[model samples]
Target: MLEEVKNYKLKHKNLKLIPITTKNYWEIGWLELKKEQEEFVGDNFKSMAYAYATVMEGKYAKAFGIYDGDESIGFLLIGHNSYSFEGCPKTLMHSYDLWRIMIDKDYQNIGYGKDAVKLAIDYILTFPDGEEDIITTSYVEGNECAKHIYESFGFKPNGDNYEDEITLVLKVK
Candidate 1:
């Protein structure tokens, strides 16, 4: 499920990926966030809805949205989680649990998904001191497209599975 990382261009003529700020919250909420969650995650939509609501409530530190010009094409939320690497002590840090990620259905086949992920990696790698970082994400077993994208970014199984979800991780040195 790995492919060479490439600078893929977005299909939308004037697409731009940007961080979500307070000013754009209501717009994002109305346009992207309020849409029926089932359109994005099938039966898991309820959980996804709750996740978005949590983020909106400030339960997460940061949330980003990928916009096609002024319209939201996709969005992602990242938050801190406690973790330890192979016998290390638990530390308070950021981990990309990828609570939710969605791209407009019309924009699915385009490179926006991959580009959005690259943007995420670039943003996460910017932590000061070049400290090691880890990103964790999960996808339903049959979502081949997503599995490919995550694997292409070097994420591997973490030996944990919840129902049909398989968790994967990438550690950046």
Candidate 2:
């Protein structure tokens, strides 16, 4: 644990990950979804317009934003468990599902995402008397970068795909 903490601190020297709240929700939301939509549709104006409106709509699961000083640099969305499916049994489950993760394009390829995920895993593992022995997340089919990062943290695919999402699991035990 000490080593992990040290590594995290080293990686995030000037960065801090904070939970998202109502006050800075707009900034956080725009940073998280805006770039991806623009890249997806190849148009910034429409993407920005849609993201601005949807963000205010407040329809995310659990959301967190990483900040470097006052500027939001990354965001993660964890959806609450809604149903059970094959390979991932519902038995003895007390885990939050990592739904979406987005980092600023400028911060990509650095170690920020890895450190953020480590922070999230550490937070979950510290839960007192929690039945959660695992952390579950998914990556898009063509997102090789994400798959590699999650695998570095010991997450393995569970052979389950819902639409374009491929499920991966990290066991804490």
Candidate 3:
């Protein structure tokens, strides 16, 4: 395991990923991204709805409000032992999935998105659901910014794609 992640901290120290709850979901719902970037990631409400549905179906999925101090600045969703669809690699089963992450328009380009990713990686290293070797995520093919941020942390495309999205994986075993 990448034990060092337990000590990970963002250069912007106030940034954090707080679990989304009824008390704060409303604030997370209000976060907005640039119009052109909307196609890259789903809105918080939709992502949360999917999280709910997946949990209802006996899967593990959780949403988090990405906060800078007390302000809700973004959203993140993570899954474990998921993606049972056709064409999914057998290797990805029983692994962690960085399902969705997004930063509000006002917070973009100030390094929060990158920092939030680091926090997400830190959380995954804690193995919230269970221990696993791989963490996976996908982005719409043209979302170069997402690709860059994920790649910066060693995620690599694994020759898999679903529709317009391409899958990337980081081996943490």
Candidate 4:
């Protein structure tokens, strides 16, 4: 857990991962989906437009907003090709692709991104009595910072690539 996420209680100063709903979709889609962020993740990845159309409209993915207290600072999407167009790692039963996770430039560092990733993994762990499961994600080549962060959570490069991005996986037990 990140030091910033003090607790889960409603009144506490904690990071939250909320499902994106119709009421807040448009606002969130445009808030953190900036040009630089898009280019950084490579061509195959999409931020706002792709995420909303696929996850919100097409059911290709599921999305959550990263909030600090009451403010939205980032976004996350989980899915795979089997579920829709965006495919994650191949799994025997079920798994999460961790398709997209980003913290707005303004909110970079200060543990928001780290805790958000941890929260995402925590969400995955709750699957079916918290049995061990696979969660896969990819990062654009040269983004060692991301590799480090995800690795800190036990994600490891398995010699796979999503498009040109290096693929990594975590097995939650």
Indicate which candidate wins on TM-score. Answer: 3
List candidate 4 stretches off by more than 4 Å: 1-13, 33-37, 42-60, 80-94, 128-132
- What TM-score fits each model? 0.66, 0.70, 0.91, 0.73
The candidate scoring highest on lDDT is: 3
Model 1 scores a C-alpha lDDT of: 0.60
Give the alpha-carbon lDDT of every model.
0.60, 0.60, 0.86, 0.65
For model 3, the stretches where C-alpha displacement exceeds 4 angstroms are 1-9, 89-91
Per-residue CA lDDT of candidate 1, range 44-91, in tens? 234335555765665544566678777777766555552334542232
- Model 4 agreement with the true structure over 1-173: per-residue lDDT tens digits: 22222332233258888888776676456654346556555222345556556655544456788888788888887664423335533441255667778877678766777888877776765552234357778788777667877887777788755566788877653
RMSD of 2: 6.2
Clash numbers, per candidate: 0, 0, 0, 4
What are the C-alpha RMSDs, in order, of all predicted structures? 5.9, 6.2, 2.1, 5.3
CA deviation > 4 Å runs, candidate 2: 1-10, 32-61, 83-94
lDDT string for model 2 (84-171, tens) is: 4455544213455555567777677778878777766665566533445567787777777778877877777876556666778776
By TM-score: ranked, best first: 3, 4, 2, 1
Ranking the candidates on lDDT from highest down gives 3, 4, 1, 2
